[model samples]
Target chain A: MQKILNDKLVVTADIVLRIILYLSIVASIFFLGKMLLGPVLGITEYKSGLKTPIEFSVNEQGTATFGSNQTVPVNIEHAKGLFQIDRPVPKTLMVVFFLLNLIFFGLILWVIHSLWMIVQSVRQKNPFIVLNGRRLHIIAFSMIGIELIQGLANLIKMLYLEPRLNFETIIVHSKIHVSIHVIIAGLVILVIAEAFRIGVELKEEHHFTV
Target chain B: MSIRINLDVMMARRKISLGELAEQVGITQANLSILKTEKAKAVRFTTLEAVCRVLDCQPGDILEFIADEKNENE
Candidate 1:
């Protein structure tokens, strides 16, 4: 059977992978910024309770009103920290998360730089297509693994462990927007893989055999 | 495994300069030089046809197969 394919689609997919590399860079920058500045950002809690005491009996059910501002006393001796966050974040774990975020952020940056080199290789139409593509796809697809695994870990921690920690309702590090990055990374890796495969074939193909 | 490119031989016989041959074949002079030096891994039939036509030679004249210098396993 004869098979026909618009081979240019493969080229377009490679272009899309280049774009995805840029997208990954933007994601890395966001995570890096959060990790760096998140430490200093002070935390405050807002809680309001009935200012009016419960009545023994009333014709109408009691209606509660919250004043503009309410202040609570500081319980300093009960805790041990220089500037403790009133929130439920564990100090050591938060620091670990911060460091891991930096590590992955650096990995993302490395992938971005590699993407630039791959684009250069593609643009120059390098003769050694297999070697060029092998390096590029390794970095490109490895990023997918990194982002997906870390994202899954974050989700699992939020879901299963957060409750066991006696913490408030699930919070922290689970951004809806982050999935856009995961999907983008996966798609970009797939595109790079296809491009690499075709590019090697093209480089190797000749009208006749030896 | 012992096939060889006779492009240089044909080009010499036809007195066609490598630069002129590359220009006729729609490829770079550097690439033509590589092919003449037997440094290229493979060649396209379209390129071979152009060279053959320009040099008044056949594909067989531009390419050759010889016995191995060493054993096949080696």
Candidate 2:
């Protein structure tokens, strides 16, 4: 019967959601552990000593500068932007960067977990419940929050951190951009949440009708 | 609060049991119970016609309207 098929489909979707939820939780825990013990365990050395094709050398006066013998490709001029660093980044800065990344990942995991809860309700054939609408609203807002955090982090990197480095110069190929598409997608989800609320009201009315 | 179903009164007058009336009217017992208890929000014309046919009564005999004094005061 069609009812049996629908129930099976919902069960499968529930299983998939549970898998994703477990994965997100494990990833979040791993990131949290790394952030907590990274400084003490000398994990910062691996991240700070990143090797690149471009080399730097120190002069007799102890001034650090880029090596002139480095080969420059013709298309290098058309690259998005240039980021030059004179020295290795400090361990404290690396920890802060990791912390910011962890926060972003946490927000993403929260959105996924909210979706998982909504799907659980759907599997129970109660998709029109008020809690599902609230969960959808949470997902929409979390998506917008993630995009805002990403934009702010980018701005900080461009304005404050980049300028503080002595030999760092970023050639402006394009303006700093925020993802307008993500904001629009969040608005769409918000509208869908409102529609779900109205649907729940209508379903309740129908249930009471003869 | 204004519209009321008089299904139970008509069934009593006709001397018909709930199960007999529901079977003759081609509706479930639970649904007929809802109509008899006046708990239904609205009745369909087809269902009303079936019930009237089964009980040998007019539509007016099964449905009644009474105004609420609270609405008049408001």
Candidate 3:
């Protein structure tokens, strides 16, 4: 009698995508934790509010910028900080910060979208995503978009606010924090690359014919 | 999950060495070994196509579904 083990490509595309989606989510949580750790650890402080702990200070030209959350106390010599709010136009400047942060915010929306799609697939028990499904592409593009947004947001803030915002006075100054920010962003990109690898490479096989 | 592969019996029936099959299939002996030993995670359609061509037999000849003894007892 002949004997062999079953090989039915048990790993369906749905299962693969589900695994990748969950893996990405786990990586994202790690990212958020790493980004927020400094403030939680009391290594840095947000000067503006106790909740954020990031110190904002303005440069000689009267513009200030904010950094990732840290809670070192503020000492404004003649009142200059990480973010400079011109008394005359402080409302307009606040709006800019809100927009800048929110614009990059879409990446978070994309992440949520991908996770939701995975859950739907799981519930429906779809074996493989429909060819060119919107969810599949969103998962891929959203992850890539998240990395791009984080990197670009930092650059935008730096170009617009860095010179005007002097973080030199803060005990946990910008230098050490900025590098960690980049490293965490890089890890997110690496995970995104792995997701694409798993998604696009797997192929279906048909079982035996004479 | 319930499917089984019966390469061993087919090989015996055909009287061909695993090495010969590997050569005919143009796959590495190690990979062929994995398939023969049931350690393979997956089998490609091309590989299945190759196996059928080399053996001159249908896949059904090499794979079978005996109602499991455990299932029968139950």
Candidate with maximal TM-score:
2
Q: Is candidate 1 or candidate 2 better by lDDT?
A: 2
Candidate 1 ranges beyond 4 A from true positions = A1-99, A114-143, A152-164, A167-188, A203-210, B9-16, B20-28, B39-61, B66-74
Quality of model 3 by C-alpha lDDT: 0.54
Candidate 1 lDDT (Cα, 0 to 1): 0.59
Error of 2 at A14 (Å): 3.6
For residue A158, give model 1's deviation from the true position in Å. 5.2
User: What is the lDDT of every predicted structure here?
Assistant: 0.59, 0.73, 0.54
Q: Interface root mean square deviation of every model, in Å? A: 5.4, 1.8, 7.2
Clashing pairs in 1: none
DockQ per model, Cα: 0.13, 0.42, 0.03
Where is model 3 more than 4 Å wrong at Cα?
A: A1-102, A130-137, A140-144, A165-203, A207-210, B1-74
State in Å the error of residue B64, model 1.
2.5
By TM-score, highest first, what's the ranking? Answer: 2, 1, 3
lDDT digits (tens) for residues A107-205 of candidate 2: 888888898888788777678887888888998998888888777656655654544545434334223446899989999999999999999878766
**Candidate 1: tens digits of C-alpha lDDT, residues B1-74:** 47687887887888888888888888888778777777667877787788788898888997787877676458
Q: Is candidate 2 or candidate 3 better by DockQ?
A: 2
